[model samples]
Target: MEPSNKINFSRRSFLKTSALASGGMLIGFNLFNACKQDVKMPVDLSTLNYNDFNAFIKISPEGKVTIFAPNPEIGQGVKTSMPMLIAEELDVLWDDVYVVQAPLDTENYTRQLAGGSQSLRLAWEPLRQTGATAKQMLVNAAAAKWGVNASECKAKQGVITNANGETLGYGDVVLEAAQLEVPENVTLKKPEDFTIIGQGTANVDIDEIITGKPLFGLDYKEEGMLYASVLRPPAFGQVLDTFDASEAKAMPGVVDVITIGDKAKAYLESEKPNWTAQLSKSKKVVVLAKTTWDAFKGKKAIRATWKEESALESTEFHNEKLNEILEGSKFNTRRKDGDVKKAFAQADKVLERTYEAPFLPHNTLEPMNFFADVNDEKVRLVGPVQTPEDAAKTVAALLGRNIEDITVEMTRMGGGFGRRLYGDFVYEAAEISDKIKKPIKMVSSREDDMTTGVYRPSTKYKIAASIKNGKVTGYHLKEACINGNMYGLIPNFFPAAAIENYQVDTANYKSNITTGAWRAPYTNFLASAEQSFFDELAEELGVDRVQLHMDLLENVKNNPDPKIEYSPDRLQGVLKLVVEKANWGKTAEGTYQGLAVYYCHNTHVAEVADIEMNNGVPTVKKVTCAVDCGIVVNPLGALNQIKGGVLDGIGHAMYSDFVFDNGVPQSNNFNSYQLIRMGQTPKVDVHFVKNNIAPTGLGEPTLPPVGGAVANAIYKATGQRLTKQPYMNNLQAKKVVG
Candidate 1:
């Protein structure tokens, strides 16, 4: 695992840190930026007055302020919204504040990741305190200059004004403020007095993104960086048998063909349970060349043979197994309140139905790619990694290098629904660079990203409900899914404790078609199945759909369980808001409505889809969504996430599915996969509940409810109960009679 090349200390140090002491107000969590501690700061440490700010704030003498956003920005708007939180409490003008994506520095910023919609939730308190501390420091500086009490000075929009009307801008005081001691305690602004948080501020990166600036990982480049294309096993559960790269080596611009064996086992075994690394394991041959096109051409020129394992199973096999398990498997009880069998026997009526969701690919707009420069001394990795710390761990372990020697820098990702969470691509680039003794940039083509990537496992849900005295008194859910060992966090789902007699059970079937996190994970399938069944139960009882949901929520509210994770009040809050906004009871001309609600990631979201059949095809005309994610960080960003999640869910429900045959994915690209197009997207109306609660994540909570909403709406439009995914497939199988 040792690198062949030796490194020089002076040159390596320059690449590690940023330019820290260029004569300005430099504030950061870490002391080392562009040089080692042996090199003293350009300014005197005493004159520079450094207080203990957690991380990420720098003010130039000329009034330019930069705040480094700690988390990765995978189209979640953290880069813009997080900085707004800092600038808002600091009382700085929006125009003067600039944002930068912070490099991976675990010592300074903890949990610097983008997943589970938790970036804002975890950083809210510390970031607010950081900004408030800076503001207090500036005020203290001004008070010392004027020889007045700090309380007498009022600060707003980067300026402090005294009782006598003497004003000093933050820029003017920053140099002197840098010399003042940071306050031990500072009060944050009340919600009623906020200016930047609730307001609809546009994303700061919009101009750069629109103008085609080099921000994404695919756009990254460096001097002497060689391009690489990895050739993966043709199918899942297959291994590399042999490869003849002699033809590829002779090609123009081709440098080397290196094979990366399974280096993930050691890293995964060291951890308790690392499903991300487990799913990301792959056996591949990397073709290195001068350019991406050359690498691609070289990969095409090479011929590799793969050996298919006998245990490999296909999608059809999995579907059959799921059916078998659902029909006869003894389900392990995850959550149970009452005897399901006894409750069903005593009920006036019983309704049972099965729902299925196929395996799905992330299909990120930018395929997996990473750049790595490694030697015996240091390992430098730069790419679109959602989990930087995890990626660094894998790289360090694989290369047998010190963790400190590894530096992971994140670039803006084109899209990572949840795909980039696995640092497999980062490791692959590092491994290739180490073996080849050169800097490498590994890229996965659209085909490689789609076919070889970890997919959202196929799932089956068998739900039964019992109606006694005109009310659903009992509920049972039996889930059988694939890749249960990998991403089985939530065993029991919402409404489990809502009913008087509720029983939840699950059974997992193992599969080799790697599955990891996909948006809201299991809720993506569970919400559709649970809500659809609830909708059917409502119909059987002759109750309005929305009213039925409200009644169940009320049941939970009246007889609350101590173990209930979601608040019935919050659930009802969003359901009522969505119904009111979507005109639930009224049907528009040529349109039918459907309702769905679910809670996940400590956020409650309800959505209603308005649909109309266009030439035998169900078309979503409009959608109304109501969210209760506590406080809104940026209204514009939250709304965008809500709208995007709805559209993404609708697209997946209506069209997306990945089918495998003989251990190979049948759908290779967009042509066969069928993604929801922009023209087919429905008009969406978003609303958020006003509350004093701290902010939660909005990126994923809005997606889970969408499938159920659309399915329920389709049932209203066509009177056909579609139980399988890609609802269009079921709709197409039968023509609606005129």
Candidate 2:
């Protein structure tokens, strides 16, 4: 169940507050404190009138409000939308507010990271309450000056008006508000009353982004900072053995050549499981130079030899191992319900299919880069990172310094997509700086980023279903992947409780290739496989595809499982909404349509892809999507996310393929790799399910369903099942029956 957004005032206590140096007010409070019954003693606002509070809001003397957005903005629009939550309750005009990225402050913020799409979902209540409480404090101050009951005064658009119609700007009573005791509770604005939210607001960084401002990590620079280009092992199972840097040291503008990562190697050898540890390369050769070009040139001059430490695994090897695992019965059962053996034995017919996907690189627009200055006093790190707290912790551990001694500043990321979450580049920058005792900016070429960066795990799923009396009696799903499986995370997702006899088994073949989250993670491919399987299932049962989904959802709703990870009502809502919006089952003469619905990252999304045959090839023309992520914070940003995700999902499923030859990446650059171009992008029509429930994530949920919709649509147009990713490749390999 979704948590209530209603604020409980009696149990809440303000944390800190201060009068701004610029003759304004600053308020800091922990919204989570409302959950605690025992209220802590409020700090004396009068004594703590200094400008050092970890405050979210700063009201200037001119009535302008600067809201510090506390989450990393990786083009997810949190920098703009998160502050909207505060400004909405603060009763400030959207134009009167300015949003700024907050620094990494564990004391003042929670969940500063940007993965999992949980930013807005987790911040919904507390951020609203923070703004509401500040508004109430302003109201109290105005009421005190006017000699009227605080309840008689109402605040709107940064102004307070009393019963007699006298008005005081928020700036006018800033000092008094700073001295006033924080109100334990404040009334929040209803959904219908929201003016800034639910309305289309331009992204806060749109101007800077379009104007080519220095907002990305690649644009960050400091005087006297050296540039670094590192050479790592060419393959996954290889380790850096030795390197001769004399020739590189003699290159033009080359400052120094150093080797680092001994400490990282020791840490990895300790057998301690850590996300950062998995990212760290045990040894590397860094070429520090006066310029980025010089660094690159020097790096090219270095001759390094690597020693094989383990099997040099390739894509063919991965495919063999995965297929072997799926074919074998030695599997760990993730979930089992009812009697699968009996149901299958008594079944009249059985249908089974396997879906396969290759490993994928993040391929972020901006290659990995970071700036770090490690001095005896403190460590200053600045870059675009999804997980600043984790990066800081990793740097502190590597440098043998206290985490408090490190400060991290987040720049707007060009694109993360879970790549920057690892912070491998950040560690390298800090390690290089600590070794040379000078600030350094570490940058990775596109080849370096693609060949050596962490990747999305390759996976295969075998789904089997038993049919009796034209109804699915038993369902079994087995997943085989490289490095890890999704059983622990999504065992109770859709299709778990919908079927009477359901069982999920998972097995994995551990490889030396590093794999981590990529966008929606497992669901990015799982949804495609599951949705395509459902379409095939519908055909096998001689039922309408949409009707089959409705039946399964109805089963889930009627016999609700407490452990089910999705809301049947919500899932059904999007499915029905999309069906109506997209005019499902009705298409033009040349257009064939297919639909898919999925729930993940706390959001429910439904998509319908419209495809047309062009020269015996299925081409996507348009995509209609419906999303239920609770209340829409910024319609414009929400629309951007939907469209971007749809296009990204379609492009990757149709073209993005990453393979390895003996652990060496075959597609390192765009010359060999393929991406969807503007001409190929389909028109995406996005609609949202109107609700007052607290907002959920939108960044990733919209992506996971698009691949399924596209694949199913291709099947409808070509009469061929696409069981492999890079659907274009698979489609071309098979005859197109139109």
Candidate 3:
């Protein structure tokens, strides 16, 4: 049967109920910000209508259950952990649940972007309830069938057994269970009764990944499907003066050539500052061909002129400007109750320093790619994307059809690192199908994937503290937030944090550059700056940085302020654990190490990085992390996330970043962009703290501290302070500054 070029909303809306969604937690968002929509139902799930039942359950007549998680896995191992939540209450063997990736429908989806470590933090409660409630519903149906009270039934694995020795599989009760009214509120399972949650389990997808299943978008294929490639700008904002599709389009297997980019009908009001019509602004030549090589040939032969434009101001320029401004100490941005000025004025010693970092890319293993099938009737998209609802809405709007007419199928992403969350790349695929009037697969080359992608905004942090009697009398942090609008990335914008007297003054030096999230986003910079500065100050006062943080934390705890409301329990937990676990202050002969702790993505992680120099190059030999996410779903998966974050941070510390000159990046591919390799892989040991509380997230919170840890370790090993990253070139500057 041929699918209509048009997607039916009936099927999209039908897949709404919660079930085992490919064993991973997923998040979903529509493309446009102003679009408001009612909940929709899809007509088919696995080619059958499945989602109209509720937010989290689909029971088969034969007893199998499907879960619909709203967030992307992105190799963080949600494919195993998130499912453990529902499986705990469902009382089913994990194998009994069939996991399918949720279709893109926002109403039933959670915050679909899998960043900020909120995957388990946000999904833990809802998913657990979904499981328990579904079980209770099934029990209610079974009770009615057996003429027994629901309390007489007990669910174990996939069967319901009564005290009378009668038993029936879930398949026997699901049809009747669906007809029963869902109770107003179903009592969830207690921890004591949980067999799956709070217990160690291996990742469900490990076998799949090892076997090389075609779960990722790059692995997706279709018969007679044409491949497409795009030629991007030389640098950001380097516009195409002219180009011809004639010669390249005639190449072997080349089907069509299309120019793709963001076409803003009008500059409507948006909080997003630093917005520019850039060469990197989603514009490209879509190369359509019969094979990947054919697409490559057409892409290689394309010729275009890159327009000269004013690039972003130099990092040095902004660094100096921010330093000068902070020296004036004009910060009222957010302050706690303190006479910090008077304290600083009376102090016998005053110290301050400026820290800065350049923009960096999230070079995920799997580059950006998406497949969209659009005909005159309906639109369907499949790829490894963090955003499905967003992609669907984009295709619908671009196709001039209703949002309900688009279908988005999310495939497993190789890695997110906060890059795949941007739905812009998905729009690239939809635009090609709409233009070429045929189903097409769009793939970005490694070059296009890196240089053309958005990045973590480079930032400069200035901090000062006044010391008296070996104690900090006054402290303030003035951060020059480069882009004025990284605030729009919030998923639920609730909760509060600690820290005060901090002014994040943003200035836009909008160049032809594009920017997006990378890991913890701004928190990575903030953690390195704030935590590293604390370490420096501790050394100045002849105190341990870990001890100093504990002291400050004590003060914060006693006076709990609203401006910066971090998890009090977590803050204290990681600090103590790291110190104890790493055998802090223990002798290691001549080895010097540094420590840092940070809480983000609902999880708190503290790392101790042991460092030693090998031929003047900083080498990290060991990393000890104390992670607390409440409970363990898949210990191995959680460990993998922590290890990945550390390696990623190591890359950022020693060999990641674009060398910009005259508005163009000197380094564009992996050869120039240094990522961590196996030779440098440190011994990473992760220990999750024992707690009965809910599990948070483990993806990104573990990253921020690795930089500070290494920086501190370098200082210990060489009686030198290294303030900058890519430890080679900046070593000179850091030594001079010290």
Candidate 4:
């Protein structure tokens, strides 16, 4: 019951036909590299079968190859780059290949989540194997027909040729190939032979995007789908007391006014597992209508009373609690090396600085929307979800249905930035549809999307550096924030492994405001604080900023530590490359340059931002970034992602922050909050370190360094070192877009 005309292999008849075909290989691979699945895969595969895979390519009778990308594409270019891996190994021309977005099928595609920027890293080998295995099967099919050894035949650009000058297009031999048993051991192509991996390529959907095709979650539609809008509380930790929807229910086109309290309660107390039930337990009243405007109008007309929990407090109260925790000596140590106290006490001078970053909302372009149809037979949901399998599980838990009965199809996300990582929206949509026993499309307005919970946590880092005779002798960092210890904040955040006497202390502040990963997660704010501290330390020691970082990296390189997760060589590699490209030592009039480097998501990135002060307001003119994420799959796509990350980082650091008053967010819409406009965006140049390493993630690694780079550049321009974020606060002047 698919809405689109695209071919789907999950249908029972397609599998039966494929299984009957000769020499066709249906291979299903798991994300064994991530999620702690350390079982070694052997080449021996006498037990291999076509039913064991979730995604595969089939060569039709017309020489067309369609590769399915399992992971969600949140503007990260995964939808195109993943197919490139298959095409490169399959020896097929890019034009001959078509890419398909795979629906969530955990039985076939295990570990199908796109967080941590591990999509490319995890899929690199398995996808290549899928293509290579199919290619080997096709080559064998051609060899059997030619009565020659398989090695003598080669697959090139969807055609198989023999040494005797015999040639057959892959479409001609696919039926024969589908009948043969799949080979266990298939050779993969070397990097030197890659014709498409490193080349610049446009997104596959660019044409559709330019022509205004329906590809995103917001564009989803159906014949009998009803529009829905929910009336949620004004803030987090608030409960709906009562609702009077008489006026709304009597309005034109209004179908129903349903309260979500009973469904939410049943979900939490249901027999199904409640792994994420707490997140999905939000209570709201839904308005179902014939159209989106009717639903929105009905929602606005509804009268509701909300009661704020007594424990939930204001932003000022939370900051006070944060300050109290920072001042308190009781702290949990995450990382520690040499005696930091002795090093600090004996050093010639000790510099201390505290940096703060506020909560940020994921302002996705499309907002949150999902189409769900739930009935006694089955439940089907489709929308822009980063983790479709997880969303299915959540819906299954909520609806008391089998996971297999819940079908969750992923659509192209307008933006993710980790906000879509949660399946609450999907669960919400499913519960409403199941309650109404009809297909419903739940859409979130910009205000609903922004004011809802799950924002980037407001964090503060108190850093102390001990300097003796122009060298950093010791470093201590105490991070005070809500759930700092839980959200992957390790002891060796940055500069910790580089310094000998280093320690990381953390204090957790209690708050009702929800926070989740935004872009690079903790590294985003950490880089802003750590890199700015290094700049301050460089100035205090009378050393160049670029040289100062090099010295620390040299120390880490020469003296390695096991606690350090990043390679000093890689960190140094990007720093050197970016400094050279930015012309660090050289200066131009009307511009000041600042540099910063960070390692995360198995990738190292260095950014140099050039800023110009106009009427005391800083305007970023240009940015040069160098990244080392191993092989660049689709250089053009990678460059676009990097540029987008840079602009995203600058925009968030410059103006994005969620303010709360009595547990309610103040910045509800664009009018209150500012986003980086086209005029304010800087010209960007991106470069990648040439290496033979496997490709890592590019979705978020480039973002962590942009804020620090721009902040350091602003310091150089204004001489005033602004400690707090939204550095524009220091100027107290209006934001000038240039």
Candidate 5:
């Protein structure tokens, strides 16, 4: 289940602050526009406060609607885009809706996470309901005043008007509406009646973001705040042997050097954590700091050794074991359709392929950071966190504080492709706060953040397909990897891939490398293997890749891929839509190349990548995409996410990945790792399959397909199927790294 509650946001309590968040200005909407109600929807609060405010929104005496955003904004545009969701249903002018961060009350918030592309999709139902419900309540209140049947009154753009056209603004009836019981149900406007749902609303926080507003963890500047940094073992499980802090203490801006070697509990359990977890390990650490830089920079001054576990390296962290296990391992047969072995044997042609993807980092633009002030009595935390409830619980358990004693204020994230969802770093912050007996803000350098990240585990895919008489017959997908006990998590993780004679067999290679959610997680990896493999199989059968996939997808749409608990209609729809948009298999002139698509999250997305090999460097000129996620909370916002996801994937495929030696991570800074720059942004065309389906996630599903598309296009250009990531260097080493 794509449940946001997985992070346990329900466990935390919010400590109310006297500070009023802020006011929002609503933009004008087209009035008198005819609207239809094609899609039935729930009308009421869409999101909850991380605090105990079940009402995600409230209308002030001035008619301003205040929406409490549950998810951290983190450069995902939720800060601006989500509020638009609430406002769309509330039937208020954009100018009149003000947005604020929901306080830390896990029970009140929806999902504080910014991954899975679900922020908008999942929130669509509740947020729209929130606005619609409030609108109904106000309309009723207005009707009671004007003595008209509620049906005779229409609430639009903050005004409740009679059929005769007499009206009162929302502010005029605010008190009565607030006192009235929240409505039991309400009807939403039809798409034709839409005034704001799909409009190109600019980011609500653009001014703040552009003006260097103090809205992020880095902007946190409370007085008496001390900065902290930790020196963790290079790898998890290794124990710190010796520490010499003499030189670190003598450094300028250096206050003190501290050592912590814990055999009982890793890092002191504090009612308040330091909010800076340098690394993920059950092991303890040594601390040094005067300034964050001094603490962070002093790592060079300390001499430490670790007793590495022999099993650390002995337990192979690769898929060679996976190949061994998949061929001989006793796996639960996920699907057995039409005697796949018999079908393969009868086929005129049989193809087998194996693909692998290394571990990936959730390189959020904003490094993970948190500010904490923990004392014996209570602890306060401020940063970007996906699961406040989990963070609070972890802090409480570590610090011996009641859940009520901890307060987590989630800030706008710089960007979180599933990285901030993990609560470990937040736990670390809480620990440091309690340890130092003072409030501390821990800032993770990009180096620390990227290297210490929980990665998308390396994965392997072994596949075979049968092509008979220019027709595809059977398919097999064998997947292997570890993060969760994959052996147990698949009917859930790769349902689509595990269809047909699909077998999901996994072997664990647990390591000190912290692992957490990264966008669509394993699905992205499988998309490359499954989609690309399917593309090749189609070619083998003398068919267009699009036509081939459409055939398979049509078969699986309702046939129910046994390995998948969910049907594949959504995936089929997106695949069809993208192919149509890209004009798949149609000859295109010039140096451009072509590719196909795949799905992730609950959403479906497909893309056709066009590239020109210039000086051996692949110049991605344009990308055409199609997505079907049901409703559009904000079409502009949705499209931007698709565009951004594509670019991110393009950038990673070109120049991002971590390398390590003897357990120490390489590619620490920008020099080692390169981000996509303005010079390389390809033109992206996003086509949405407009429908009334409850929205699904958009942030991640669009990403996975792009990497393979680019690779496929490069294959078309160079005739070499490039399988490895950050293919830029190899291309560039051949003198074409763009």
Candidate 6:
């Protein structure tokens, strides 16, 4: 069932209601005196009393239920799906619900970040209980009006029906309901009885997004707001030395040029260092102008020189360091089981392979931007930030102001993909506003975003397996990455418990390059490496690849470990389902297929890639994916995420490449960088496992296994092992010579 996207009120009506609500004279009701005899309810629908049911909900006199979505919507459809959980349990019609993005309210919402894909998983129970409690309160109010037991009256679709068949709208009893003591416990609906959840619902902000309305950070503006273009060090390991901004200040529409970072540098050097200092650049040249284009133009006219603080590193340097770390004896043992030495000694064959991937930028469609209005009185920050609370706290600390004096408003993001998780752009906006003591909108060009962005750490993995008498015996996996390793995050994932003689080691070489989470984080590349290695191991063992995975899963299921991070039953469920749906071994002429299954972000996913040769090049034609994320919420949004992750994974593994030459990024724009074009995207068929379990995560789980599936398929098509990422580069180098 598809929920309607049509809104009941017109745009003008919404604006009027918003204007009136902002004035505090309308849509406001005293919770304590809601049932007072002297209190009067307004008649106008625009001015109707909207009693706050809880932090997440507000009910109006007209029965219009407004559900507040606390998490920032980074195109993951949380704005639509999270509210569905509330509406489903509240016994309210989906059409009668209006969703709003809630401000940062620490008193009510916790974990208000958009990264880690834990938004829904963490809020699942609490949000449902919140709705159920409100519904029970309304039922109790209706029962009091009828002089009957609360159990005799039931609420459904905003209406309460008594045993005598008499009905009353929820609005009729909302005042009295507000006066009743909050219920401690309320019954939640069974998954089987859900009418709103498990159904596809259109995005709540789809209209605003498609109509070119102000939704994203780039579209935000305020009165007397100046546009800011900030110039920082052009390369890593470099700091600001000197700059001449006279030419920039003379540019048309240019307002002024200001230097920042002195205060930040001082704060960082103090005895008590602030964590926000690491988020923003320590030195910058800001050009303020009346328009965005003018600001950018003025920034280009500035002449700046940088001083290197350390040796400038390159891709070659990173590769050498990673390889050196992998070969070294000193390493951190993440996980170890039985004696790997004994298992290897008894093995008949020992096979090893090394896989490598380069650093990658998040490349969110919207370049980093934010709006800040900071002053001694209060600070108002508005932008697309995944962590609004963190951003607010950071700004407050930098400005030496009370956190309560700051307010953060979240705007819909064009894309996050873990990029917006860092509020550097937000910090820049706030610092510029505070320095100039004026409101300003900080903007970053595509080049600035690409060159100076938090990137996915480049990593190399060396995996080895021992086979004794045609059976897998021992496994040793070593990971070497930039800045950090995956030792802490996923030590208990698959393959850890499957092999008795399993051991995992990790090492890192801290570079000047900044790195952080990208989409699924470590599992993004680790899954591809592990899955591909398993495929090669299957070949050496003379067994089917699918059977090999099933066998490993059986081992994990039989000998369950207390620290196991994923469910064996759930992983097997997706693998079996995908095998059936993709016709595991069946393929048409000239079509080759490969399969991969992985668990991450508290979800299990299996994907099969179908590859066909197109003019001497193998191209992905279609992908069949099976997911078990527990109960599916908003199948439309779920399908979108599945397809998007698959395509994104394939694109990056096949074509995306980011390189640094002496600490300076070589690709500053799309001309040098490559992304999967429309012609390169494959057809993705998604199937979800039917279950009543609560939802887990959908934003990033489907991405981790896609690269492995594509690589395995390419091996079948071309008889070549693609070990390095940006597979197209390797494929081109190995092209048949005429």
Cα lDDT tens digits, model 5, 1-738, are: 122211111101211111122221211110111111121111233332234343245566578877656666766677777778668878899988777776565444434455555567655545555566667777888899988899999877888899888989887876566556545445665655678877888887778889998887778767877777766666544666666777777788777666532412544343454332324433445454656777777766877667875334312445555656557655545544555677788889888887766666777777877888888778999887776767776677666678888888877777777677676667666777777777777777777776666777666677887767776666666666544322233334333443344333444545555565666666666666666676567667777766666666666664654445433666666677777777665646545455656655676677888888776667888898888877676777777888888898788777776655555566677787777888898999888887766667677778788878887777677766665666776553333222
Q: After superposition, how far is residue 308 of candidate 4 from its true place, in Å?
A: 2.7
Residue 681 in candidate 1, Cα distance off native in Å: 0.9
The regions of model 1 sitting more than 4 angstroms off are 1-54, 262-273, 278-283, 485-493, 732-738
Report RMSD for candidate 3. Answer: 7.1
Estimate TM-scores for all models.
0.92, 0.95, 0.87, 0.92, 0.85, 0.92
CA RMSD, predictions in order: 7.4, 2.8, 7.1, 6.1, 7.2, 6.4
lDDT of each: 0.79, 0.85, 0.67, 0.79, 0.64, 0.82
Query: Which candidate leads in TM-score?
Result: 2
lDDT of 6 by residue, 488-589 (tens): 337788887998899988889998788878889889999999999998999999998988988998999889899989888888899999999998888777
**Roughly what TM-score does model 4 have, to 2 decimal places?**
0.92
Off by over 4 Å in 4: 1-53, 266-282, 732-738
* Runs in model 3 lying further than 4 Å from the true structure: 1-55, 244-247, 262-283, 309-339, 488-508, 733-738
Top lDDT prediction, candidate number: 2
lDDT of 1 at 94: 87
Poorly placed runs, candidate 5 (over 4 Å)? 1-51, 107-111, 163-165, 261-290, 310-323, 330-338, 482-501, 557-577, 586-592, 729-738
For candidate 4, lDDT tens digit of each residue in 210-312?
8989999989999999999988878677888888999999999999999775666676666764433335345789999999999999999999998865465
- In candidate 4, residue 70 scores what lDDT? 69
lDDT of 5: 0.64
* Steric overlap count per candidate: 2, 0, 53, 13, 46, 0
Clashing pairs in 6: none
Instruction: Give me the displacement of residue 706 in model 3, in angstroms.
Output: 1.3
Measured on C-alpha atoms, candidate 6 has an lDDT of 0.82
lDDT of 3: 0.67
Measured by TM-score, how close is model 2 to the native structure?
A: 0.95
521 Cα displacement, candidate 2 (Å): 1.2
Error of 5 at 122 (Å): 2.6
The digit string of per-residue lDDT tens for model 1 on 303-358 reads 98988765668888998999988988577877788777888999999999999999
Model 6 alpha-carbon drift over 4 Å, by segment = 1-54, 267-282, 485-489, 732-738
